[model samples]
Target: MTLDWEPAAGRPDLLADPVAEAILKGGLTGGPEGGRKVDVAAIDPTLSDTAAFCERYGVAPEDSANCVIVAAKRGGEVRYAAVMVLAVHRADVNGVIRRHLDARKASFASQAEAVELTGMEYGGITPIGLPADWPVLVDENVTRRPFIVIGSGVRRSKLALSGEALVAVTGGQVLALTV
Candidate 1:
């Protein structure tokens, strides 16, 4: 489970198309060393889920984050946003999110809808390369982590970065978003 981490900016092949493009387009900066904001490692695609990936990679649940797409509806309109929380915590999607988004109802987006919208595999959706209009909500606990393992927008790989870097790249709003 020893991962050979490399700067994500240098390994575009490890990222999904939109994800690579996003990174090259201001989502990240710096070279392959100290200044790099994101890093990546290949993984078994089948172990892409948070629990399985954490177990396989020997990653602590607290050091891993899960990103889920939420479909919030207000009246006749629907909005999509990404919610990020540590693997040890569950996002407060129904309560806090519904209220924050001012939606009548809030629920996880369907698999097909998620993949189609984000252009990333359902199980590997990261907050890094979402639609420009979609908000990225990050849990306060996640932001405290010095390093975190998140999706790479593709099941076959995973990205590693600091919570602050994630927030800076996605313009994430840090909040108490756990149940």
Candidate 2:
């Protein structure tokens, strides 16, 4: 089916986000070596609840990946970041991520902070087009799926692609970093 985007409103071009573009381009190719085909679906931007969001799209929570932005703080300083993973597991903030980022403390990004840094509506943030330095965490469960649904750079849209294709394009590291 042909994909449809939301009405434009001074938003950045879909292609302007390199990560989104890469996923889009990857979807058009045959497979991993040739890229993967992505099926895009649009929805309401306010739907941040993963379970409800998936239900609306006729997808199970297990079939969807949630992209959450986290901020690590140390010495009274705050850092903005993003992480992507399956909805079935929570982020390993105290374990894998803390060590991965070398931060003494870390937690979910505040609503205002996430909106400001990522330039995405709270429920809509996707790892695509996120700051390059921010680490994209992939839960080990995600690798087990042949295909998964992820945010499409907007809360209203989602992309479905092969797991391998996403790994190749994002160069994301697979970790047992979920609880």
Candidate 3:
């Protein structure tokens, strides 16, 4: 099934973003049998938000994934994790995440905190190239899809990749993250 998004590699302009450039450089996942290869595509900045992007780009919500940064506190120390989930579902931050992080509670990172920690825009944060120490969690549902479009750590472009690629990222953990 051909998607409405144009191929990202064919357009050099979109590569200007570091995250998008890294993905093209090799952030993609494995081939079929393992997973679909990653792809990149430029998008309108106005459509960066979930609703607007899916609507204008002719992409269904399930085909797009949301990468969210969460923080938790334990004994006066702070830890973080990055989670990827389908737009159709929500991450169980307060439950599964808090337990996984072993924190008293887990909460979504604020716009400023997310941007500062990941060096990516709040709406554009992707799991690729996140701080290595930060746990990268992928909800099992995300991997079930053949292909998913995710943030490029910038609002100007999106990264397309197989569920395998996301699952294969070093230290990536798959869990039942959705409520």
Candidate 4:
């Protein structure tokens, strides 16, 4: 059976983004060659808050994985990066991630920087279809859950997938990287 996607309000252009296109075509995990269908849902852009989004969708915040990209500066060089952190455990910005990225200084990417570099809207970035070289760090806690809700490559929508499936697709490293 083919999976269908529901479009969100006021953002029909979202369907054109590479990331969203990837999700609609390949699913949250890209699926196995000819795998079971994965469902995609769109919501009002005003309901973009992580907690609220999950609540409306009947998913617990703890069961949702938030994908955040941080730009770090090391030796005066800036690097773009992404991480999959369980909503329950915030990314260890000052601890594990800072060291993992080998940044002399690390911080969340500014709204403008994130959108400009990733071509993804803020409040809606996922590691699934990111650039090939971008480092994707997955928090240990996220793997413990059966499934997670992540961005659908757009701010107005999100995709759900099995935790194991996510690891398999992204080839992401499960690390003790959360605060």
Candidate 5:
């Protein structure tokens, strides 16, 4: 099924504040018109989760990406990062991700922390507009996809863009982030 895709640059109404700001500011380049080619579509808020969204939208598991927030702690310091993986796979949070963050332990961030820190709803966090200091780790498999669906930083909508575009917009690091 076709989603009502529209240029993300022009659809701030469908985006959360940070998401709209990121796209409007031209992604990471910070140029006058440096936004990546992204599309947005409104969806049922109750079905915003990966499985429900994919099923209701007729999106394949491999064509949908989930962005999870990780809290890595070491030596009394805590850092947060965003991990992007296909819905079909799970992010290696305790293994590869922990090592990558140079932390003694890594796990999913608390919903309150994620929502507060990212200025996004709990179930609607996207890699885009994440804090610059936070690393965005994209699973290699995700980068190979021509297009994928991800959250719009709000439960009411979804974003669609090429995996390459996602990397460019978020300055994502491509790696074997999934197991």
Candidate 6:
């Protein structure tokens, strides 16, 4: 349950990814007790999706956090958020999220929109470097893991850290957000 991350520049796949670079450079805000923050582990850049990543890295699906961008609209205002949930479950986007956002409806953001808005690849958008104004919703289950593996906003690497550090980095609200 410990975080072991190497410098991103030492890995070619991660050297050019901004989000991965941000995590490696200590750009995320907030600190847990003892001043421990966050860290990144550069993996094979070709592991482009969650399933491949976990299996290749000897990580379990339940131990990896998935970041999903969701949106809703009311009165012509679209509210967007990047929600974190473990790979073992799904985000209650149409239920808990619709209620949380106070919108008439909610749905996952399109891949194109998510990539464009987050400035991260479709398979790698993470909560760490999301737009400052976007709220990060973390599933209560996700925060319970001693350590969680997450996307680094690029296909080339992953970020690994404590669950508490995740809450701190995203400034997230822990809730029963999975179905």
In terms of lDDT, which candidate is strongest? 1
lDDT of 5 at 112: 93
- What TM-score goes with each of the models? 0.95, 0.77, 0.85, 0.82, 0.94, 0.84
The ten-residue window of minimal lDDT in model 2 covers: 1-10
lDDT of 3 at 17: 53
The reply for model 3, stretches above 4 Å from the true place, is: 1-36
**Which consecutive 10 residues in model 5 have the weakest lDDT in total?**
27-36
Instruction: Estimate the TM-score for candidate 4.
Output: 0.82
RMSD in Å for model 2: 4.7
lDDT of each: 0.89, 0.64, 0.76, 0.70, 0.88, 0.76
TM-score of decoy 2: 0.77
Q: Candidate 5: where is the Cα deviation over 4 Å?
A: 27-36
Tens-place lDDT per residue, model 2, 50-163, is 776776656777777887787888888877656678888788887888788778898888888877787666676776667767777777788787767777666665666666
11 in model 5: Cα distance from truth in Å? 1.2
Say which candidate scores most in TM-score: 1
TM-score winner between candidates 5 and 6? 5
Worst 10 residues of 6 by lDDT: 27-36
Which regions of candidate 2 deviate over 4 angstroms? 1-37, 46-48
Can you write out model 6's per-residue Cα lDDT over 45-97, one digit (the tens) per residue?
77858888877778889989999999888898998998999999999999998
Clashing pairs in 6: 45-156
For all predictions, the C-alpha RMSD in Å is: 1.7, 4.7, 3.1, 4.7, 3.3, 3.6
lDDT of 1 by residue, 91-169 (tens): 9998998999999999999999999999998788999889999999999999898889999899999999888888998
